[model samples]
Target: MASDSEVIARGDWYPAHSSRSAAAALVPRTGELIAIGADGVALSVSVVSALSFSSRVGAIPRRIIFADGSVFETADNDAIDHYLRSSGHKSVSCAYRLEKLHPRILVFALLVILLGVGIYRYALPALVELAVLVTPPIVPELISSGALSTLDKTALAPTRLSEHRQKIIVERFERVASGAEGESYKLNFRVGGLIGPNAFALPDGNIVITDELVALAGGDDEMLAAVLAHEVGHVEGKHSLRQIYRAAGVAGLVMLIAGDVGSGVEDVLTQGGGLLALSYSRAAESEADRRSVDLMRNAGMDPVALVRFFDALEEKLADHSRTSMLSTHPGTPDRKDAILKYRAGSD
Candidate 1:
C-alpha cells in the first residue's frame, strides 16, 4: 500500500498468465512493484533486486522483467535511472551512462572518429595491396574482360584512326613496351568521344589510348611514348586492380552492415568500368610518372618530352574540362617539378 509519492515509475504490466495488461508502478526505497487494476493493488511484489532492466537509449521505451516471466514497459527512463542510482539495485551498463553528455564521453567519441580516419587513410591501402598479391591470376583476367566490355558499352567507341596511322603508332609503342620488364603489354586505340584526351590500363596488361590523346600529342613520338609508358607502369604495378579491390572491399563492408545489399560486388566489377580511369591515387600517379621517365630514358627517348607535354597541355587545356584526365591527375605544376627533379637525379 505505497502512496503515489513512493511510485518511482509507471508502466503497463503484462502477466505471464494472460496477454492482458494493467497499469503498474515501480515503488522505490522499499523494493516493491504494484499492479493497479480497476479495484487497485491487484498484485504486489517485493523483488526489485531480482528484476532485470533493459539498457536505456534515447527516448526508446525501457523494459523491466520480473521473476514470474512478466514484463513491465515504460517510457520514463529518467525515473528508472534515478531509482537505480538512489537504491543501487545494480550497476547500469556503461553504454547507458555514456548517453549523458559528459566531457569524457565526448573525448572518447572524438578518439573513435580519429581511429576510423587513421584506418581508412593508412591501413586500407596497405591491406588492399596485400589482397592484390594473394588474388589469383584468373581474377584480374576476369575483371579486365568484364571491364573492357563495360567500357565499350558505356564510354568507348571504336577507333576511327586509319590502319596506316595505327600501324605507325603501334610500331613506335613497341619500342616503349620493350623496356617494361616481366609482363608484356599490348596497345589498343579508341575514339574516346566524351572521354577526351586520356590513356589508362586494364588489369590484363592492356593499355588503352584514345584518338584524342594522339591528336593532343600532335604526332610527337616521344610524347606518345611517354603516355603509353605511363600506362604500362600502372599495369606493371597492378595499380588499377589494387584501386578496384580497395573500392570493392569498402562496398563489401557496407553491404555486410546494411542487410539489404544484393549483387553490388558484381555490379562494381562488371558495370563500373567508367570509374576505373579516374580512380587512381596521387601517389600511384606519381609512381607511374617516375616509371614513365625511366622507361623513356631506357628506350632512347627523351624523358623531357613528358615534362614538355605537361607544359603544352596546361597551355592547350586552359579550361580544364569537367570530364578530362586533367581533372583527376595530380596538380600539373607540382608533378612537372617532380619529373624535372627526378630526371635530373637519374641523369
Candidate 2:
C-alpha cells in the first residue's frame, strides 16, 4: 500500500482500478500499480488499460480526483483521452483533438473570401473610375497615326502612290468590313512602303499594312484575310479602349494623391494620344487572338493561314535582322502555338 502523502514527480506512469459493493463499503479492489508522473501534479491519473502502444500510451480512466476533493467517476475511454489531450498530455490519438478545432479553420476561410470580394467589388471599380478621369484622349490617335505614317514613309509609300493598287486594297478592306458583324467603323489600309515587314491594328479600328509584309505574303488574299481578322479581333475586343482607361486611371490616381491634380490632369489630356498608344495587357492580347481565330473561321478562311502568316513573317523579319515587327507584336509564336493546340484538341 502507498502512502496518501506521497509526492508524484514528472515522467511517471501508473495503473489504477476501482470496485463498489451493495453495502456501500469502501473496498479496495486489486488493480495495477500505475506510475505517477509529475505531469499529474495537483491531480491524480491512472491508466486502466493500454488501448494503444506507441511512444505515448493511450488508456481508459477508472476515476479522477480534483484538488478540491471533488471526484469524477467514469469508464469512458474517449472522455479520458479528450481530457488528457486537452490538458497537453502526449497521447497516441492526439490527432483527434486537432480535428475538434475545425470550426476555427472554417472561420479563417470565410474571412479570406470576404476580403477577396471586397477588393474586387469595391476597390477595383473605384480604381477604374479614377483612371478614366486622368487619361488624355489624344494620345492613342497620335500614336496610331504616327505608327501608320512611319510604316508608310518607309515601306508602303511607293505602292500606295500607285492609284490602281491602292484602289484594289481599298476595295478588299471594304469587302472585309462589309462582312464584319458590328456597325462597321472606318477601315483604312495605308500601304507603308517601309522595307521592314510588319502590320498592326490601331485602337480606332484602323489597319496599317507594310509593303514588305504584303510582299512577304506573296499577295495571298487568305493571308491578308488572316491579318485583317486579327486586327478585327483587336477592335471587337475594345483592347484600345481598355488600355486607355487603365493608363488614365493610374495617372489620375497618382495625380490626385500627389496634390498635383491640376498638372496631372493637364498632362493626361495633353499626352492622352500617347497614353493611348500603350500596349494592351496580356489578357487583352489573348482575347484578341481568340476573337481573330473565331473571325477567320467564320469568314470561311482557314485559321491555319494565321499560323502560316506568322511563320512567314518571322522568317522574313529574321532574315533582315529586324526585330521591330516582333517587338510591336509580342506573343506571335505563342499565339500560333495556342491556335494549333486548340485546333488539335477540337479535332
Candidate 3:
C-alpha cells in the first residue's frame, strides 16, 4: 500500500485517452485529484466541484460524480468515506441516507400495503354505493339497453304468447306499474329460452315476463300481477343498477390489488354484463319484495299470491333451494316465509 496521504482508493480507472480501464489509485496531490497506474503513469483531474456521491446497493460499488460529467466508482467504502470527509465533500442525497437505513424502508413499504388494502376493502364499497345512489336516471337506461340487447341475442326469444294474453298481461301490469315509484314501465313478453320461468326488470323500468312464467301461473292474473308488482319493485328501487355498479366496483378493486389495473382483465369483468340483470343480492331482493307487497295491496291484489307463487315455483323446480330466493334473488327460507307473514299481519 502507498503512504496514507498518497493513496485514498486503489481501484480501476479509465483515463481520458485510454479505451481500456486499468488498476489505479485515486490520490490527492498538489490540490488536485489524480489517478496513478501501476506503470508509474499518473493522470490528473481538476476537481473544481463535487457533484454527487451515490449510495452503494448491496455488494455493488459506490459511484461518484464530478462537476465535469466524469464518473468514479469504488467498492472500498472505508477509503471513499475517509476521502470524502477529509476532502470536504459533504454532498449526499436523502436517497443515499435512506438506503443506509434498511429497516425503515421495510416498515414504510409494509405500512403502505396495509393502508391500500384497508381503503379497498372498506372505503371503496361505501363510495361505490353512494355514487350509485346519486347516479342520474338516464345512466341506468343506457346500461339497461346494452344489457337487454346482449340477452336478446343469447337467452331470450321472441314472444310466444298470443296477442290476447299479451294485451291482458300488459293491462294488468300497467295498473300495478302506475302506482310504482319508478319511471313509466313498458311491459315486454319473451320466451324464457334457457333461463326458465323467470321475470326480471331492467334499471330503466322495462319489466320482462317470460312465456314460461305466464304459463306457470295457469292463467291466474292475480299471481301474474304479483310477479309484475315484484319486478316493479326492482325497478323502483334501482336494484339492477346498484348490483351492476357494485360488481364493477368490486372488479376494479380486485384488479387494483392484483396489480392488473388497465389490463385486458377488465374485459373479463364486463363480458357477461347481462348476467348482472339476472342476479340480485339478498338485501336487494328483500327490499324489492317489501316494495312488491305495497304495490300489490295498492292495486287491490293479495300479496299472499306472491308467497303462494313462490311456494308453487319451488315445488315445480323440484329442488327446494332452486326457488327465486335461492337461485339469483338469494334469500333464506325465513325471508321467503316473512312475505306470507307480512300479508297476514296487514290483513
Candidate 4:
C-alpha cells in the first residue's frame, strides 16, 4: 500500500457500480492516486485495481478508471501522467511534450519553419517554372478567353479605332511577335474604361491594348509595337499565372504558420492578393521591358522608341492626376536608363 501523503493526483471519485447509484451519490469524495508495486495502482479509497486513463475530445479533465467499479478524475493531468510514468505503469494521454517546453519539439518546429521558408523562396519558384514549361499551348487561349470575357463585361469597351488603323497596328504587332511560339498570339483593342493608357497580357496569349494607349503613342507604330512585344514577353514567361500562384502560396504559408485563429486570415490573404499581384507584375514588367528592347532591336525598330513612349505616358498621367501604367509595371526612369545603356552596348 502506498502512503496517503504520497499523493500523485487529487480529484473526486464515485464508488457506485451502476449509473443510477453513481448519480445518487451526487457528492464526490476527494481521492488520490499513488504508486503501489511496479505496475499496480490504488485509489485513496483502499480499492487497488488495474488503472487506465481515458479522455474524450475537447474534454478538459482526464478520467481514471478502476477495475473495482470506481472512478477518479483530476484537472492536473500533467501530475497524473508524471506519477503513472514514474510508477512504471503505461500512460496513454493526449498530451504534447512540447507543452512542457521539450527541447526536441521546439527544434523540430524550428526545422519545419525553416524548411517552409526555403520551399517558399526557392522550390516554389522552380516548381512554377517547371509547371509553366509543361503547360499546354491551348491553356493560355482558354485563360485569355475567360479573362477577356470577364473584362468585357466589367471594364472594357469596344475599340473605337478605325478598322483600317486597327489592321495596320495588328500587322505591326504580328511582325514584332513573329518569333514567339507556342502561344497563339491574338491582339485585342479595347477602350480603357477605368484603366487608362494600359496594355496588359492575360495568362493566355491575348494582349489587350487600350485605345487610350494607342492614342497616347500618337500613332507611333514603333511605340505600339514595343508595347505589344512587352505583353508578348509576359505570355512567353507565364508571368500572370506565376503571379497568381505565388500569391496563393504565400497566403497559404502564412495561414499555416498562423494556425487556425479565425476567418480573418482568409480575409487578409484575399484582400492582400491584389497588392501581391501588383508587386509581381512589376518584376514581370522589368522582364518584359528587357524582352521588348531585344524584340525592337531585332525587328529593326529603335529601342529608344520604348523609352520615349514611357516618358510620354508618365507625363500624361501626371498631367491628368491619374496613375500611370507605372503603378503596376513601375520603374520608368530606371527602365529608360537601362534601355539606353543596352542601346549603347549594342552599338
Candidate 5:
C-alpha cells in the first residue's frame, strides 16, 4: 500500500468513479485532483469546480494535496464505506420509497372473488330456474315412454277382462271430457297393476286406474265417471308437472356440487320418477276435487255420486296406507266436505 503522503500526492485517494452503473462520472473540485486508473493506465485530472455526482450515480468524496506541505482530506477514504453510501446514489432509497404499487394483481384477485360469488348465488339460481322449466315437461315424456310401455306389455296385455269393457270405459271418459276445458289435451287411461284400490293422474294427462278401483265401483257408470273426473282435474291443473319441476330443481343442485351432471342425470331422473309416482299437494287435491264436481255436474250426472264413491273408497282404503293418494289427492274427510259444499250450491 502506498503511504498517505504518496497517495495524496498521486491524488489516489477519493473515489474517481461511481460504483453504480446508473451513477454519473465524478471529477475532483477546483484546487484538487483525482488520480484514477482507466483501462490499467494511471492518470491525474485537475478539477476547475466542485464535482457534482449524478443523481443516477453515488456520492464520491474529494482528495486534495496542498502545495505548502500537508495533504487535505475532505472526508475519510473507504471504498466499502463509499460504496455503501453511494448505494443511495441516484436517490435509490427515495425512488424505491416513492415507487407506485402495481394494482393488476389486486384487481385480478378481486375479479376472481366476484366471479366465484356470482356462480354460487346468481348463476346457480338461474340454472335451477332453467331446470325447473325443462324438468316438468320431460318427466311426463319419460314416464309415458317407460312406465306405460312396461305396463302395456306385462299387465294390460294379459288381463282376463273383456276388451269391450275397457273400450266402453275409454269411450265414456272421452265423451264426458270432449267439451270440457283443456279438452284438446290428449287424454288416455290405462290399467296399472299397482296394488290397493286406487287411481292416479299422470303429468301427461294419462290416468291409471287400478283393477281394484274398477271392481270397487261395481261397474257403476256414474261412479267410474266421478273417479275419472277427479283424476282429470289433477291433469288439468298440471299438479304432477309442478311436482316434477320441484324435484328436478333439487336434484340439479346436488348434481352441480357433485361435478358432472351428465353421468348422474339418469340416476336423478330415476329418483325423480319415484317421487313423481308418489302424491300431489293438498292444494292440488282440493282443486281436482272441485274440478270433478264441475265435470260431473256438466256431464248431467249427479255430482253426489262423487260423495258416494268417496265413501266406498274410504272403506276399502281404510286399512291400506293412505300416504300415496293422500299426498296427491285430498283426504276422504276433506273430499266429503267439499262434495257436501258443492251439492248445496248451484252451477
Candidate 6:
C-alpha cells in the first residue's frame, strides 16, 4: 500500500544473524524482493532470478523462497497474489496451475485414465509379443517344469489309464506330433479330477491331456489323435509362451489398478484371468485348430475328428456352459463351422 509500484507482505522470517524467527515484511522493488526486520533492519535482498513462490494451497501460508535457502513465510496470501499479478510473475509450478484451475484437473485425470486403458489393451499386448520373440528357450523350460509340478500337487493327479491304453495313445499322438515342433515335444497324461476333460500345451513342448479327456474320447484313436495334434499345434506355434506373457501383462495391469479390490472381486479377476490365459483367445484357438488340421492331414488322419470331438464335448459338458457358444474358444458351433469351412477350402 506504500505505492502502486511496491507491495509488502507482513510475515515472520528467520534472519541469518537471529537465533530465532522475528517479525518481518517482504517489500517488492523494481525487480527484486527485500526483507526488513521489525526495527527496520535490512535482512535479505532476493533478485528476480533467485526468487521463487510456493504453491497456493487452500488457506495455508505461502513461502517466498530465495536462492540462499532462506524463506519468507507469510499468511497474507491476497497481498502476495496481488504482488505477483502486478509484477507479472507467473507461477510455473504444476501444483499452482492445477489449484488455480481445479476443474481441469478432472479432465486431466480422465485423459490419464484413457491413456492407461490404451496402454493396457493395445500397447501391452504388442509389447508382450515382442518380448516373447526375444525370450530365451531356457525360460520356457523352467516355467513349464514349475507349472507341471504345481498342477500335479493341486488339480491334476497321476493318470489312471492302463499301461496298455497309455502306450497306444502315446504312440498315436507321437505320430500326430511327428511333423511338428520336432522331437523335443512329448505327451503326458493326468487325471483331470475336477478340471474336466481338457488338454493343454506347456511352453516347453510338453502336452498334458486329462484322463477325463481320454475317457471322453470313448476309445476313438482318431478323435484322441486329433486332440493331441491340436495340443502339439499349440507347441509348434509357441502359443503357450505367448499366453504366459499375456497373462503376466494382465496380472501387472490388474495389480496396478487393484488398490482396494477386496478378496472376492480380486478372486473373480484372478479366476477369469486364469481362464483367459488357458483359453489363449479365439484367434489363438483358431490358429491351433488350423495347425491341428494340417498336422492331422500330414499324419494321414481324419481332420473331422476334431469337429466330432467338439460335438461330443458340447453334449457331455452341456451343464457346465464351458463349450457354450458364448464362452471362450469361439464356442463349439463357431469352431465346428470354421473347421468345416477350413477343410472345404471356403474359410
Residue-by-residue lDDT tens digits, candidate 4, 1-347: 33345546555555546432121111112333332332233332432235567642233776667666566656766766575576555644445432455788889989989989898989878876776778676755665566677668767899999999999999988888886756678898999877778888877787889999999888788989988888898878888767656665666676677765455433323332242234445667777887888777777787667887877777777676445466667667688888778778766
lDDT of 1 by residue, 257-287 (tens): 4555577666767663534544677888888
Off by over 4 Å in 1: 1-115, 255-264, 272-278
Q: What lDDT would each prediction earn against the true structure?
A: 0.77, 0.53, 0.71, 0.68, 0.56, 0.74
Q: TM-scores, in order shown? A: 0.66, 0.50, 0.63, 0.61, 0.53, 0.64
Q: Which is the leading candidate under TM-score?
A: 1
State the lDDT of candidate 5 residue by residue for 1-347, as single tens digits.
22343233222332334322111122333454444342323233444233232222223443343233222233333432353364443323343333433587678768866765666567755765575456545656675556556556655433344678778777767755764665234434444454345566665667777666677788886888777888888777766656555555545655555555563435334442353355666777778777778888887877767787877767766776463555456566777887778768845
RMSD of each: 11.0, 16.7, 12.5, 11.8, 21.7, 12.9
Model 5 per-residue lDDT at 338 = 74
> How would you order the candidates by TM-score, starting with the best?
1, 6, 3, 4, 5, 2
| Stretch of 10 with least lDDT, candidate 6 | 267-276
Any idea what lDDT model 5 has? 0.56
- Backbone collision count in every prediction? 0, 26, 0, 1, 6, 0
TM-score, cand. 1 vs. native: 0.66
lDDT: worst 10-residue window of model 1:
37-46
Q: Once superposed on the true structure, which residue ranges of model 3 sit more than 4 Å away at CA?
A: 1-117, 261-273, 319-326, 345-347
What shift in Å separates residue 332 of candidate 3 from its native position after superposition?
Answer: 5.2
The model with the greatest lDDT is 1
